[model samples]
Target: MNVAAVLSCALLLAIWGLPWSDWLGHFPAHMIRHMGLVAVVAPLIVLGFPRLADPLALSPLAGAVLEFLVVWGFHLPVLHEAAMASSVVFIIEQALFLIVGLVVWAGCLRTGGLAGAGGLLLTSMHMTLLGALLTLSPRVIYALDHAGALQEQQLGGMLMLAIGTPIYLIAGLWLVARSLEDTKDEMA
Candidate 1:
């Protein structure tokens, strides 16, 4: 499982974090790429290899906060545009996405394992609200290399809602079920 998770992350980064990212240039593509890495890859790796927690001594709350700030900070038009023009910010952005993902999962695993329902829920809600804001906006929000800025932003919003939200919800519920099972076993 750990190897599979690592491979999955490697494949995703190769597609999104490398030259293809420059080739794609559209905001939604970038947003989906980042979301896919954090929401999908991070949880898979952490759950597969819990030993990863030792290196990143992070709390669930701090992890969530850091993830939230990094995600939103990057979405800001100025910074987003800067990343588009420069390679350095793009690299930094991708690194932060991976690190924040690991930190969030580590936070959950360290404190209560799957019993960290609140942290997971917080992550879900954060993605939902961000997506909703983008999707429901009356005007175009981003300056992209492509023509359909509004459409791209809307798609990005949908990806967050459709993809990110479900992943966190499932993970949280899975954790809750595991904790309950463990409790019953102990009682028995």
Candidate 2:
């Protein structure tokens, strides 16, 4: 847990540092940095938190679904355009991303192994699809600059695919391993 806390703090520093830097705050960096918060930092916070029972009370799959909606819905061109159009909307979008991300990770961490793993697998697949969509799109989806948007989108997608996808899969596999251990204990 202490290790988790340390990792969380490190991720936060990275997240906060990006916006201050002109070079790092751009398209692919911004998106990729946010993913670090969502997929890694948030999970570490959850696993490190002193009280785990609160989030564990909810259904893991429900959290996963909510995460899917929040992440996918917010990232879409229409919604992202709205966020970009206003500072308030952008703040809200980012807030929801962090909050929902925490909930989903907590749920996956605390729920029964099988349910968590199953939900995680589904989530990974959904994220994979989203990444593919972004990566394969020929035109720039966002109105941010329109020129470099395609390359940026593809980079963000590649980040999701290369980094985000593996986190979910590894977490799911870990849950599966835990499940097997518990089953063995019960059988014995």
lDDT tens string, model 2, 1-188? Answer: 48988888888887756563266334566566657767888788887763752544357788788889998898877888787688798788877877777877777777859998887888788888988888898887778674666787788788778877999899999999999999999999
Candidate No. with top TM-score? 2
Local lDDT at 87 for model 2: 75
What's the lDDT of the predicted structure labeled candidate 2? 0.77
| Cα TM-score per model | 0.85, 0.89
lDDT minimum window of 10 residues, candidate 2: 18-27
